[model samples]
Target: MKNKYYLLICLLLSSILGGCDARWDQVLRVKKVQPIEKIDLQGIGAEQMLPVQFPGKSALLIASKNKGVLLLDSNGDHLVSAPGRVETLAIQSLSQGSLLVAAYDELSAEVKLYKLKGGIDRKPVLQYLGGRDEISPQSALCFYQNNDRTHLFTIGDDGLGHEYLVSPGPSTWELVEIRPLYFGEQVNACAVAPFNEKLLFSQPPIGIISMNADAEKDEERKLLMQADQLGEDFGGLWIDHSGNYLWLTADARLQGYELKNLQEGSDQTIYIDSNYYPASVGVIGKNIVVLDEEVDSLLYFEYEPLNPPEHPDLQLVDEFIPRIPASAQTQPVSSAGDAADDPAIWVNRLHPEQSLILGTDKKYGLNIYGLSGQLVQQFAVGRVNNVDISEIQHPTYSAIAAASNRSTPGIDLFAIEKSGKVEYLGLQKLNMKDPYGLCLYYMDSRLSVWVSDKEGELHQLDIHLGQDARNWQLKHVSRLPVEGQVEGCVVDAQNGQLFYGEEDRGIWKLDLHRYSAGMGKPKLVAEVNTKSLVADVEGLALYLHEDSGYLVASSQGNNSYALFSRSGTEFIGNFRVDMNRELGIDASSETDGLAVTGANLGTEFPMGLLVVQDGRNRMPSGRQNFKLVSWQKIENILNLSSATAN
Candidate 1:
């Protein structure tokens, strides 16, 4: 009986110890003592801090739980004061001695906007700017500024958060809703790393979580440190001056995490005497200042981030690629989430300057944009994925548009009048299991459209027009069998050459004459090699030179366009479309279908233009849209100006 009781007691002890992580009690034992200094705020209140600098002023912007804001020097001397009853503060730093301030108003659970101006030995002044009528909770809020654009993030206890684009107005600042993000649990503290666009939030009982701060990016939360891993209690969180270390504070301790690559975690724990309990933390110059309310003082620690960010080879390769800014972008598609896919250019022969851009919203219909990137027309056709427009030498119509309709499981054909008018010719039911890619090929006065299913089945159909303007017909031509899936295709009318992308395989070229005679099969023209053409080759467009031109294909895997010589079918070069700060367009990625025209269409497009589908729409992030790049810029970058000069 004594042995049984002893065994049961041992089992109970093991279960309790297992349930309660022993590391939770190890924080005090492992951390080493560090030298520290303090500021006595015994009566004033919170030292919740942020660092700011101007032309002639540089100090820590201190926040008080009740007494407003104060500017404290490195030695803890209060230099400036602004009256308000705010517990938290966020700053959006700007140039010319101006910075945006967000002070949390507890009564309303919202934040009031203020613009601070102080420089050239002048006293800093804060202005009461009008803010939005509705807002998220400011209890856990921070500002993320990138490329001179400021964004406000507010997270609530319910794990719901709102992200806003902060736009300054005449006497106010506009808060535009970009997206609503979820944190999934109660948040203890939060911080933002602008350099990598990462949002780190501490969710107690679970530990720290980091996610992409950009609404246009993947917003999946990744656990950086588990609750058991954070040996100490988490009180405050802040990103260090280098934007490399994500520092978390607790009772007498600090944990710095090198978050260059979140997947490869590297961190260090610095534990101090347990006499301090930090409630606020931030960076001032190269030192760390922690607000410890237990003694009503701010503790300053002389510390620097330990290690440099780890950059893998893939990251280096990404930085090595040259970026080309966009000059203009079309109005976003009406639908969202992978809706916009392909674009087709419809050149008005009568007024070539007024050529229109046709884009497909795979979720809804079609959209047409003008040269200046304005919405001209929108059609509610159902789920058209890939679209192509070509000059049709028909009696009733000058041009026609063809697309693969996933909703109807058929082909949608439309006619374009000489005056830029689009009339629906209706859908042509086909024998396709799942039609995915469609392209129009106009050769020798004959108009044909090539359509492909997701399973690599390809079919060509000749389009015929009746005497009536809206009456159009499609007759099945010959079928071309491919090995795998295909999407992008283009035809060289002058050379009777047809090029199609087999996605994972590569680009294939088929001779129209040989295929017509049933002699040979489509041969691989370009393999989806990592050197140039990445897998899932998409959106093929031919730039017609004097005689032989260049074949531009979308290297979908890499967000680049690869150029191949039409004469030898050899890869020449590739270029990526990058962000344009002036135009507020983000870099193009995961491109779908693209269309290029070599004909000089007036002054704006003197050397024609290239319209490619922007897979991800960002920078004041909205829905997806098509980006237009000048052929001149592409030629100049690739040195194709001399090659295509003719």
Candidate 2:
């Protein structure tokens, strides 16, 4: 009888352990990564492809890991890969059939350059630009042709920008007539395009300057636009094939101007709503391709004709289903529930219904919902502060949620699956005061997460989730002192940097990997003088339009937003969201939640879509209870001189 009892006990134990193993398996399954859905426009390439500019006759090129530059033909059938690896730092195609590539040399401080013929077989062009030397090959090189000669212009770390004239003398090439362009201020990058044997140089926080090919005498420079007030990093510039129109990326927007009118101080600007941080921009035929390195997505937008092609009155062409549900039904499945706040979409393969939607409720628990708006899983996290999703690996995605109580303060980890199963991964125990915002990114090829607190401090947490997402762990990496309440955070992986916005202190910059390695410290890049723009700032976005860059921040007070150049030193203009005027409501409207979408100009919903929170009528009163605005109307509002006049 004792032996029989032992056998039964063993069977029961095995059953319980098997159940736990199954639960763990489901949680790790959440890591499966998936590709985002693509929206197609006429004359646009696949959404997954990064659009790059090639030389004449060739419209666009896409970067490949193994192959060099893959040229995209008209039929999309002839795929040709160029020979060299496309450097992420600097890649520019010169008019004289040469491509300039920039990469880090043996010493991290010096940037090396290589000149390639037909996108392959690179030859070392320029070696190291010493620390004291003003120019570093790391700067973005602009190619322009004047009087049958090509010129390369770039700004270095020393805040001095130079222009080099390339003279090809039948046998060898030489860089001559190098002259100083911009001084005192750092030139992030410059864009050059030819117009009637003259080159147009665009320096942000300021407008465009035209330089002619005169070796001995200084060329006459003309101001195309006034940008000093717009904050120094306004955006990049793009000139069309005919050099008729100039495009600028400013404050989460794309503005186009007529080239001739720009020279005469009669430039007409049209705004396109682009939400992603635009890093680089290119013109492919009539379509505009923008790369947002932060979001890891490429956008293709076409120019709309002065007159409508088919339908002039059309506003919206098509509307895709909201990846995140407008409202989630709150109910307790196995644990507890409360009102949901801050819903974020996770697009990955493991939990595919778009994976998961994470939010917080006052009931001290983190809520997880499936794509169908059903509560499949719940975690007992204490007062969820903020949540961020990072794509780790297949069958093992990680969700970092900051949870803290008055007594215990730390971040909780949850490994979940599409089936609503959840597992409690360990937490990074930090004695922080009040952790509020969290942002995650891959820096230096390592999975790192950053958390910001109310006391104006940012902390980095290193997450170690094995390739098989089943096991996960977290370790405290580093912490940096900051100012104001850190609200919004983003990581520029391409540049290996991290940015956070202070409620009243403006924007702060930190070297992610360098800080993680305990080598460098965080520094202040720009301060949004609260006395100037707005009182309370919440959200921050760095939009890199082609070579130009813009830093956009949200001012919660008076429902307005401010634009600055990429460096965050200069102010461009202040744009107010008159919810009452736009929605025809009262002054009681409060704006929250902003997102930018990219669409072709000629399409029905060209420009893109802007999602905002409407407070006119909250739940249990209004029909939809929220407002989703189109980008076209927002563009019209932003472009209005009176809206930004204050």
Best by the TM-score measure: 1
For all predicted structures, in order, the TM-scores are 0.79, 0.38
CA-lDDT, candidates in order: 0.74, 0.47
- For 1-646, candidate 1 gives per-residue lDDT tens digits of 7556544433433332222223324222232444467778757777467767767656777777656767666677867676765667777767766888877665555667778777657777777775654344445768887445788887766777777777766556777666667776567567787566778887877877878775544566788778766544674777654566666775566656665654464345555567778777766665667777667687777665444455422122233444567778999999978899999998887788888999999999888888888998888989999998888676656788988999988888888878887888888888888889988888866788889988878898898766774576779998887888889998887788888998898999888878888886788878988768898798998887456578889988777888888832677888888766555576687899999988877887777788889877866567889998888888778787555321
Q: How many residue pairs clash in all the candidates, one count each?
A: 0, 23
lDDT of 1 at 574: 86
Stretches off by above 4 angstroms in model 2 are 1-343, 348-357, 367-380, 396-408, 415-428, 467-470, 513-526, 529-533, 541-552, 563-646
What does candidate 2 score on TM?
0.38
- Model 1 — TM-score against the truth? 0.79
Judging by lDDT against the true structure, name the best candidate: 1
Worst 10 residues of 2 by lDDT: 26-35
